[model samples]
Target: MSRLPTRTDTPPAKPDPADKRAAWADAAKGVCIILVVLWHVVVKDYLQIDWHIGVPVPGLWGALGEQFLPLRMPLFFTISGVFAANAVLRPWRVVARSRVAGFLYLYALWLLIHTAILALAPDLPTDRATSLLGLLEQLTITPSNLWYLYALALYFTIAKTVRRVPRALVLVPAAALSAVAAAGLLDTPGNRAGLYQNLVFFLAGLHLRPQIERWAATANRRRLVLTAGAYVLALAAMAVAGAQRWFGVWPLVSVVAVAFGVTAAARLGRWPALGDRLATLGRITLPIYVIHMPVLALLHRLLHAPVSGLDGVGQGLIVLGYPILLTGLVIGVSLALHRGLLAVHARWLFALPTSRRPAPRHVAAAR
Candidate 1:
């Protein structure tokens, strides 16, 4: 079995200073985070509730979001891997204190928080543990919407353990595991499948850091266009052939989508206003990721009845606007709530309470 790095090993290198030009990574994260929020908005809120509006438009929105399934979380994990490459190289004591402990702490803290809040709105359409045993399951074997945190902590440990191994040794198995999970051969409960399927992308982000950085830095419109075209064509072909879940199809699709996502991020980040704003959102994605679900649950409870009772014009408006509008509202509320918690010195809600200064924004937001 592999062991953690000993203290006598070289210390972790300090991260690069935040470069305005590298806003592409954050932009990529912004695109991914928005899609994630949109997915939850469509699935958990729009699709779940009995809409006075017809299902056709809502269903269309859901399908469109589904088309990006290969992109969102995979891209997020890839960028996270890129950001975490440095941190995972540190001695066990440092990696444990900064990365592992912080993630598990937030996972445990927010697991309770999610449980308590969701308990109040049990009718809202979302997963929640109804019993102590179920809650224990979530803390251990199962994964909730908060699975990203759980996976991050685990991935860091796995990457560090295999750091001394050959690259193929780590990546090949991770890719095969992803292919297996994406094929649904594995019975992953709740969001546990994501924990299995996305390991390869994260590892790629770590192992292929130099190439990825170069790709981002040198990305141009032609490459973006080519990648986007290739991804869309591949995705469409798979969907048309209905082979999306065939043993290895989904992983290939995701790799193409990730390339497209990175290229698009690089292109988009060239625009000053958009790039800066996305970079800003990327910096705070952690808060949005953890807080959005509960906020959406509450919002669903509050708005479902009112929205369901809307008349024809209101219903029509909802069909056209519900997913995007609801996603934006949820993200806004989540960010505000995070700011409020910080103001109250409830910093532990987001991170482990330690005397060490918080990790730099890029390093910390990888989760």
Candidate 2:
């Protein structure tokens, strides 16, 4: 059995000066970004199964998606909620400083970048800058995958505001909100059923983080080996079924089930290297996230004819690897960028003791 990953420093109660950049949540976010990238890689060029020579494997693409659909954007929001839970009562400046500086800026900035791509690309559906729909359209649907950022920002802002409410109260309303959307009476940003799935996950993360983290700490190191295998097997089963749309009544059941299964597997004990690197990658998952669509699309378009040997199954593996690799590369680059950029904007991306220190008693009390 493999040993669980140990946090050498574990970001101290106040995370030391030298340890400022280390973040556990960041690594998980990295995993989430990889999943997002993989989702796009498979779904985009779905028609090119024969692009790979002879393998007639059906649903290889969706099988990959099915294993990971549970992972996708929900975990990211959930993790964000976990960290933000501690700071919900901070002054407005703090929220704007950290979450705004990190998440909001990324959202607004990426929105423009993607909109530009959709505008100039011949392959992409026209945004028709001159038309009324174009103006409203940008607000309605995202270029492809960028909407999650904006929606996340909105959710965090709202969650932080009334976070003082009882956990039960908060959960009930969010659940009701979700039920309304599920019933099709309400809508989310992307016009998908059960939108703000990410927000609900985020809320869950905020409330459940402590318990979840502890569970990770408590799992037997040896069990991780079996649990990891079991997780993969369970996912494979779910993936195969998902490809056939087998559950009959609920297609997304695979996603919900498998995601929980993976979350459970993380406790089996992460390899120190994998976990640490993933944590590092998670911190910059946002930029890696934005980088994925263009990166995967370009790579798939470039490799389509040449890599035809794998058929769909082979191509499926390539699709899976691209996001995982690209996420690491983009985050590696972004982490450097964050170092330089954050020095100028430290208050935005991280919390510092000086800024986070407690207030002193009133001086008039000296009398």
Best by lDDT: 1
- Global CA lDDT computed for model 1: 0.82
Off by over 4 Å in 1: 1-21, 52-55, 355-367
lDDT of 2: 0.51
Residue pair clashes in candidate 2: 26-282, 26-283, 27-278, 27-279, 30-282, 77-202
Q: Score every model by TM-score.
A: 0.90, 0.66
Task: Kindly list the per-residue Cα lDDT of model 1 for residues 322-349, writing each as its tens digit.
Answer: 7888899999999788778777867667
Please give the TM-score that candidate 1 achieves against the real structure. Answer: 0.90
In model 2, the runs with Cα more than 4 Å from the true position are 1-24, 46-52, 96-102, 119-121, 124-132, 140-144, 179-195, 221-270, 304-367
User: What TM-score, to 2 decimals, does candidate 2 have?
Assistant: 0.66
Provide the lowest-lDDT 10-residue window in model 2.
1-10
For model 1, state the Cα shift of residue 109 in Å. 0.7
